[model samples]
Target: MTVSMTTRASLLTSLRMMVLLAALLGLLYPFVVTSLSEVVFPSQSRGSLVYDENGTIVGSALVGQPFVGAEYFHGRPSAANYAPDQVSGSNLSPGNATLRERALQEARAIEERDGVTIGEIPVDLLAASGSGIDPHISPQAALIQVPRVSRERNMPITEVKNAISSATENGGIVGQPAVNVLKLNLALDEQARGMP
Candidate 1:
């Protein structure tokens, strides 16, 4: 009788411990972490979404996306087709013939489209970054595209130049102040609205 009672008590104690651990580790822990993250890092917890002038969700500053039209400043070329879920790069060697040819083709197209005779095309504009989802382009890349956008949008070059400057991040601080292409394009839209 004593042995059976001890066995039953041990089993019940183990069962209670399992239930308590499940409740604490599984339920309580996740809830607390999630709740705290929502309060502390709300925008990041919600995908870092950026809004348009009209308060509509445009895209996330965290992820790189493509501009649909040519009138806008273009971001780095992507290897993953700019799919939000498929962030990646071409991952080709520097000497890869296919990569070289692709870069050449991109440079040719950009030159023709922008009506510029480039002695050397910007590497950022030609090469895909490690993530290939780089929202920012080098300031030089942005500047090269300026003439085309200004001509297409019929906005003054100065306004477009200022927009690019405004969109650049950490100029000479952390790294070369790269311009976020989407942000510059948005600024251009806002600036153009104020034009005659």
Candidate 2:
């Protein structure tokens, strides 16, 4: 009888500990972290949403969006199709034949589309970023597409080039200099409106 009572007491203690820890960790921990982030870094913590001229939410600066209109600069290729919930790298190694094939195929297509030879292409235009949904591209990548966009909108090349330059960021100590493709494209659209 004494042994059974001891076992019952131990089981009750374990059950109580489990419930307490579950409430503290499972319920409380997440709430604390999220609340702290919202307080400390409100805009970034909420996905850095970008707004259009009409106050409509267009896209988040945090993630890439696909652009195939030929009149805008394209962002890096996304493995998750620009879905924030599914964002991830391609996970392909340097020796992967599939990786090489995809790169080569993209190179050829870009050359045909942009009317540029293979050697003149910038590396960023051919490679996917680590996040796969990077919204920024190298300045060279943005500049190279200026001619195409200018011709499409019938705007002077200088104006399109200026918009891209204005959007390009130096990135400072965090990363390499790059232009936010979405912002540059939006500026291009604004300029294109009054084009001849």
Superposed by TM-score, candidate 2 places the C-alpha of residue 35 at a distance from the truth, in angstroms, of 2.7
Best by lDDT: 1
- The TM-score between candidate 2 and the true structure equals 0.81
Clashing pairs in 1: none
lDDT of 2 by residue, 9-106 (tens): 57788999999999999999999999999999998889898876767888887667889998878887676777777888888898999888888988
TM-score of each: 0.80, 0.81
* Residue-level lDDT tens digits of model 1 in 151-171: 889878998898888888865
CA lDDT of each prediction against the hidden true structure: 0.83, 0.82
In candidate 1, position 86 carries an lDDT of 86
Q: Which stretches of candidate 1 lie over 4 Å from their true place?
A: 1-31, 194-196
